[model samples]
Target chain A: MGSRIEERFSETKAAGRAALVTFVTAGDPNMEDSLALIKALPEAGADLIEIGMPFTDPMADGPAIQASSLRALEAGQNMIKTLAMVKNFREGDSHTPIILMGYYNPIYIYGSQRFLDDAKAVGVDGLIIVDLPPEEDQELCVPALAMEMNFIRLATPTTNEARLEKVLTNTSGFVYYVSITGITGTAKPDPDAVSRRVALIKAKTDLPIAVGFGVKTPEQAKAIADSGADGVVVGSALISVMQGHMKRDGKAASTMVPAVTDLVRSLAGAIVN
Target chain B: MTKSDLNTFRAGPDEQGRFGIFGGRFVAETLMPLILELEQAYEAAKEDPAFEAELENLQTHYTGRPSPLYFAERLTEHFGGSKIYFKRDELNHTGSHKINNCLGQILLAMRMGKTRIIAETGAGQHGVAVATVAARFGLPCVVYMGATDIERQKPNVFRMKLLGAEIVPVTSGTGTLKDAMNEALRDWVAHVEDTFYIIGTVAGPHPYPAMVRDFQSVIGIETREQMMAAEGRLPDTLVACIGGGSNAMGLFHPFLDDKDIEIIGVEAGGKGVETGEHAASLTGGEPGVLHGNRTYLLQDEDGQIIDAHSISAGLDYPGIGPEHSWLHETGRVSYVSATDSEALAAFQLCTRLEGIIPALEPSHALSHVGKIAPTHGPDHLIVMNMCGRGDKDVFAVAAHLGTDIEG
Candidate 1:
């Protein structure tokens, strides 16, 4: 189980340049489009796909991200629907590792161990619970490890050396280095600042580091890759792209895979070594 | 219970400030420095007699202290079991117990010289309360709310807006109370030095739970004096529905010394506890940390918090206030549940029977009142904290039960 996550990390690293990680709110806009966007991610040059499990209160999100979530909820997104979306993704592909990212409520309501087993059964390789910290990791991290699911920890810029050591202790998957200390979709951090944090984290662990929170453009991705991080996790940027191309014609909204795929292709362009 | 034995009640946290199996500052590092600063500042303020005097002055002058202990003569007859009395917090300046804490926080913020106040709301009651206090203090205010809540709780949102508060509609996640809280936290982080996060409940990190409860203690203090004046005795049972639980704590604290007075907290059981749709923390939770303190929470095996669903927005949280957690563990209070259907039935019953429309949150307690009053015998008196009125809930209730407002 440990080796599997490590291997995924190794594969991303072997590519030498950083891997583009794309995040889409599950059941956002609509479930059908959300699933299509998931399928198109790999072809769009995304090595990792982060699917947001829509929560009632994503405190870490900005207005745009919040609006995207409302649209998803309006379209009727719930735990059952989110799990179904993952199951559908598994039916078509198995190579591109899927990570379920969000706050803890949906997973809590779904039953933690039950959610973990279900994620594993349906091929969800990793989880980035925005709110869960190392001091309280015993609740989910241990159980996730037992189920062979990777519990990724988000190490923020405010994390001190002592706190970072504690946060990284036996943490699985990759160290999710939040580029900034603020919430999601607010603003991008200086690539130099993110690289400094990345260099600091690399000195402590053998685990691959993925930078997230405000890494929107290709330039931002290239900059983070230049800083020695393993991957870039882009959530709100792609969510905005999907919202932009969504037919204003008020007609049947097709799945937004094509536009998101184009955006992913552009993101990959930033990673050309 | 002993004034001299304060150490007995004092549960020391670790080097990191954790209580005995509870009470730690579990916040993001962005807020950690602020939280730590708050800890030190709170310690300093707690020792200041001037701060205490100011809080007392505000309680008496601003909030209309000594909120009534109204005896429900008809309700006692309707139950035909125990005498029923209500702590009329619904009559408070903002029409709820939220102002008790809000006044204190606003004062503290003023003393700290913070320029702005930020708060989060689910049902919008807390937001309204904060807005009112901010208005009184002449401080700029902002409130974050989930989009779903803003629509359902439109009247309160409008009320806040009218009070000159800047409303930020959070469209994130399920766009409920939790999302509102998260957004408020982000806002606090961005503007920590100049802003005060006035948590509405007796939850959150150190000082907040303690501070809010101290401010709300007036409820218990007044209830004690009022009960003594009217009945020359403390009632046998005290009831209040728990949200962030400041209201319940206020009513329950005065009776803590009277061990014979049964303390009960009613939790919102949305559909039913069996269906994963309630906020009945004390009845179904283990000790876990959320918002800022260690308490009873609705979490999965992974310890991630779940979004609680209750017919009453105030009670729809995956966690309970921390003081309730202490009370539950210490066996000082009893915790119970009332489902959405049950609470609604109680809400209608109260309005029809007593010409009073109880908030859905309190209806949960009222529903439990029916169950417990009969078992305690007709002589036993049960005094409940009627935390707020049902005006905010009429639209939601009408839509949910398919009952017309005109009817």
Candidate 2:
């Protein structure tokens, strides 16, 4: 079977527009609501879905995603529950690529081989482990590739030419270009600078390039898409939208799914237009 | 057991910054370039004679090193077994072994032309040490301290402020050492251009564990010479507390090749390990990644980090140095735990007998000494690293013991 990530990018290319990659923490607030949100995402214009396996210490994340993970954990989210949520989402949706993103410890503890088999069985198409750099390929990257799953690599403003080659060696599915040098949702990226870097990376790899980290609003998504990125990824902003609609006790405020889906819809519209 | 034959133990952390499978640069892509540059700069600085001379000069004159190694006669008598010696690192300028690392790192930051310094503190000893050096160098310093630490370690917090360092109170996680470290890492990523992160322990990425160990090894280096001078032979055992395991690493690295010497690292068993309220990473946790390296960490079944609890603020950390993990696996060091009550009793015993009020960190080690010292014969000499002074911990200790202190 072909990779869903490759198929989705190809479909977007035929449509002459960048894919809208939407990210949400699995089991955030609660598992049932999070599964409902995932089921509603594709219909709401998300071309690709990224589910965060909520971790206790998300050092690379900003306040928004960090709090989201904490809420998920407090609501009794674990690896089993997170994978079950993905399996539940796969029941209605079979086409939209689902990418699990987070640190490596959870997977390492869950047993890498078991995690790979379970993820593949549950229709997880790719992974974006933030802490596993290219230097740590032996730990997860090589094994994930062996399972025919895309081990997505992140390239940053600081990833020089020499380092970029190492990053691209085992990376599959797509390359995530973090436009800023800081954590998520903290700063804005310059569209012109991102365009130059995207062109530079495109010159090196044939894979799709998705720009994220600070691409929040519809306007920012359009600016990044116009800069030659194959996909536009938004995470913290979507999480913030859900957080804004959350009640005082951290339960979803009835419109939480709609608030997230509405933002994804706007971002998708901007990328396609 | 000679220094020439010590190559096997000394030549660790190969070119990849790993002590076996423990240490590596497990960080995001955004910080990769900065860590690589730091590695290069550290390599050059390690070889430069000028850097050596400068660090030596500061160690001797500024920080007052070659700290005296004193024999605890009364304590040894009370135990009625092994003779005990104290490696007096607490007598240093900042009242701890933390200054040893801060001075070396600050010099490197100066050589690299970094304008700002950022650090993470657990018990606030490292914060004061970093703030002290930053003040001396006339550089702006930002210290991320957990709010829980700020409340318990108020004296050290005030010292950092008096030294003109800005304290960023972290309320994340359990509001302690682990949370403070997370905030510092986030700050380092944002200010990578002009900022230099002085990690206070033998943890973090490659150069940090190796580099900080190199700086703090003065404790072991001096202890070896002092023990030989005092007894005309090497001590049979070594003991020190392990939080991030800096002071213990400092005291253990030089003697790693000496196969006859027994090394013990004491961890804080808050209430007890069985109660699940402890900072005994090697004793209670499994190997995992946090801060920057893969080491033994207190984490849940799902790999989410668990908050560590300890009466001593400095020992309340969830992870240990990667080198310690490698050493524990290699059977070079035996890791054990001392309960909060045990350490408190040891603290009072040492103050009454030795007239030296030891910090709660080393009191954990002292508690272990109380156990093993009585089991050994008189010919066995034990060297314990008195890593910090206890003045900063007076308020916390009083509160824990329920002593009503009159103003």
Candidate 3:
């Protein structure tokens, strides 16, 4: 286990509650409001933060998260800005585990070794590149794990028992069980099925299992937590809150950060209780 | 990197499916298992003689294969240099070489017991091919096409609809071929249980590029045989236009090991590569990952995919197939570009001289042929793949030529 992710999961276990892992684009609308939202997430009760490094083509994301990435890129978000955002977030808060997630092109262009070294220097805890599976681990995952940054792997419903072992081999962080087989925030995942899949994953490794993809509201998060997951991830739901506060010119409204934090607070409360 | 061991350029993609540094299974975790399964199924089908026999039968009876290799005598006389021949893949059943891949993949999909079919297209030739295969197989088909392409290639759009395909107009990411492919991938992820995505070209992940190339290699195989019978010798040169490089790879792959056969691939130079408005990935782009493989991509310094522009919708993609990237890097094939106006001039010349109105995609190749054919001796043989007919492009061509025609 890595440092911040391990400590956070241990704390959540001792607290007898599932951790609320909130996700948001690093530069959605603009960099300033995005930073404000990131700074406010931990105080609103997010135990872990997954900052999306925007790419031009986000294949695995649904419409909401896809829109957020486009908005970020349009606002001049790049790998450098994203890492700087993580650095800035680390200054305000140190306990929250920051995981950068997205496709791998920008990072590949940014130079893999350089990006990983910079990310580790600036206090990034983990990574969740959706495109890099166990087959292509040599590309980035192996290097990231060596950096003491948890290389999180997403195990989807399509991942059979044989393939699950491969997914868990080099995974340092918790196992992210994509509750649905589809893209993010598209379909609703059944709590019972998610519970069964969580147990299936937990039987393989000691890594805590986190349920994501289709987790939206407080009730859904609570239900997933009750299903024995160590964490519940809410991404498109939070981005939808930010989307509601956007102006005509495609910038975030003044209420965007606060509204997103408010929803995160409610979701965190539900998961904790 | 040893030159002595590098004997055959045909043997590629190793076990991890990489050609040099390009081409790997870079997809979301949800689709990895499916890709592996498809790879397994394709390997099995390759070994099964029954599968080969069925495919061959379909190729002969269904697709009207062995498309003629005609000598462009008038154009040869006009050029007054090299003797020119055209491998008329445009004479295939769907009027394009896309049916060759669609038929092969649909057979594989059926062998895997997939109940539905999905595909992405730019000029709608591939969409029409997939829809035709799905109709023949009695499976539900969905085609994701860019809204801009649907507007321009309306005839092919109607043909896909007429074949009972659900045409989903994709509006994201500049509304072009790349966007359509993205949407198709999303749809495949959501419906991974029973859907088989028939990637239109030689660009996708591992088995896709290899599999599509194998399926379309019939063009090159037939060209070799026909050229031997017609001229009693191998052709000196092969030329084909590349969008996602399917037709070019089809005609080029079988000849890659033939060291003496010079090969050329033409990319769409929309307004010339210098203007930064072209789709010439090899000539004007750098290596990056997109659409499940690492290849030469038209991207900015920040790695954002810059939208490509070309008058022909089929040639207006930002990236080429990974194998092409390998071939380009290793100097196995010469990559060049032809501008829109040049292709337009070639389109008119081909129609008037050869009495074959070639599709705008292959017009890029013909334009290159016109450039170099006159420089070679009359004894030299030049064969170009006429990959598609111009029936689908007549409206666009007419509009480009400043002529108004009523449908």
Candidate 4:
């Protein structure tokens, strides 16, 4: 079984700091650089990592992440390369958990059983596939759990109490609560309102809740922690930083990895009590 | 109608929505909450006089419904068959039956207080229809199209853009209609609140198939009256192509009570059914669940859906609508296949013989007319629902045949 997400939550809580979840596109720029960032993330103070398994179309993601996915795909990244990258991550850092987030079709194309076996073998801790809804858990969730890998559910602000309960019931790993009603990178979430909702979900679920989809900065992360969230997930903001660094003419990109990691590091410190 | 007559044709899925062994609410547990809400809202809307009045008004005003039942004299004579009548759905504001459902769904979206309309399209017909309604209601519209389809159907892409809809070309999973659907569903998951997913066909979770079918059934409702008035008898045969089977089922539904009528659904046979290249779900597929309902699917032995191929993009789906599956199993409608060669022949036949170019999707049905007309003879009247004109397919068809479509 892969390392449990709760293990990190407990560690972060004992240290009096909210868990810092950083998202990076798996093959962004290329596999080599992405692997470096994946290893660098934990050292840079990110308590957890959400590794984007770049699908050709990442519909739920906003411009930054989507563009990064395009760049990754153009650089010849697929599920095979993505899993290989995770395998590399496992070689060095065994404590930090990695979640593979993307759509379902790639998994469907790659045999579900084969994928589960491969993901588990590579030390992938979980998945946050936007397209694989709770109804579709039979396709991958069972196998993922059987292989001891978590299959995280992306819960939204509009996910009502009843729907939230159902999502929570089926969910295996931590729940990534989207703070806003809009697409990723689009909404500027009201932290107080998001926290109240998170608190309600927390009441319903004994599982850890890592709020995502708009928690983009140190301030937002600190606010989410204050509001009773176990973890604060930041994705688009770091992507925006990386994208801003890379020139679009499609040449080699130097590692803004250090600069982006600096931002996540600052957020991680802010989340520390 | 007599009890004996009602026995001739089958309606339903009776009210509770059961179509023989197929179709019952086989939705995901999460959507159950939303589905219940929709069912209640639809029930109230169905009974409200204001709802019907508003729909009737819009159908008349915006869509120009009650389109002419065009009698194809030249083509009928050349084919030497029973007289053929075209339901001029092509005359509807968007030049297809798609708008009929779009207007209704867009209105429902408005009533539900949604500020955004989202849809996935295969051939761009549904995208155009949804965009048209979005413009009329002044809602922000977003369309998801497979990157491949976006490149193929460029004109329709421009049409949607001109109508003020944002087009997001989906670049995943073979980038076809199915991929577009996956992306659209993902969009709905993120923006479920204030967004009404305007599904293009009679597919998706429960209420959508039934709802879209109901809206499109106006095609049959109009054709039935027109044919009855003109021929003084119902058609001996009713034929239309099936993709998600919306257009076919729409025209066939109202005629279900008429025992004298024989119904046929033409599926795309890319090369030929015998060559293991076809979309003839009832003929070749096994029963399986896909796109939210249990239906006949063209899946491999491993239960993986095989990619379907067709000269016509609209008719190349790997599965049939659950209701159509029910109709096929119960022998209410005969499902058949038409090859690329056959459909192309029919496309050329219609243009040369009748001066009306039918879309490749409906031309599958058009090709079947030759086989059936000879068996039934000229005395037996067959009314084929010519669902669309051949504009979008002209480029694809012409390039295949090595002939340029003259302006």
DockQ winner among the candidates? 3
Question: In model 3, which runs have C-alpha deviations exceeding 4 angstroms?
Answer: B1-5
Sorted by DockQ, highest first, which candidate order results?
A: 3, 2, 1, 4
Tens digit per residue, CA lDDT, model 1, A1-273:
344456666776776677778888887778877777788888889888888887545566776677777677768777778888888988887677788887664565577788888888877888887666665576677899777788888888777787789888858888888887677867778888888888899899878898888888888888888888888888888888777767764222554667778878988888765
Predicted candidate 3 versus true structure: per-residue lDDT over B1-407, tens digit per residue: 43235799989888988999999999999999999999999999999998899999999999898999999999999888889999999999999999999988999999999999999999999999999999999999999999999999999999999999999999887789998999999999999999999999999888899999999999999999999999999999999999899999999998898888889999999999999999999999999988899999999988889989898999999999999999998888999999999999999999999899999999999999998899999889999999999999999999999998985
Worst 10 residues of 1 chain B by lDDT: B2-11
- Across A1-273, the per-residue lDDT of candidate 3 in tens digits comes to 448999999999999999999999999988988998999899999999999999878889899998899999999998899999999988888889999999988989999999999999999999999999999999999998877889999999999999999999999878888999798989999999999999888889999888999999999999999999999999999998898999998777889888988899899989888
For B305-374, candidate 4 gives per-residue lDDT tens digits of 5667788877767777888887776666788888999999999998897788888888898899877776
Lowest lDDT 10-residue stretch of candidate 4 chain B: B24-33
In model 2, the runs with Cα more than 4 Å from the true position are: B1-7
Location of the lowest summed lDDT over 10 successive residues in candidate 1 chain A: A248-257
Score candidate 3 by DockQ.
Answer: 0.84
Q: Rate the local accuracy (lDDT) of all candidates.
A: 0.79, 0.93, 0.93, 0.79
State the lDDT of candidate 1 residue by residue for B225-270, as single tens digits. 8888989887899999997788898888767767677899998888
The TM-scores of all predictions, comma-separated, are 0.76, 0.98, 0.99, 0.76
Error of 1 at B340 (Å): 8.6
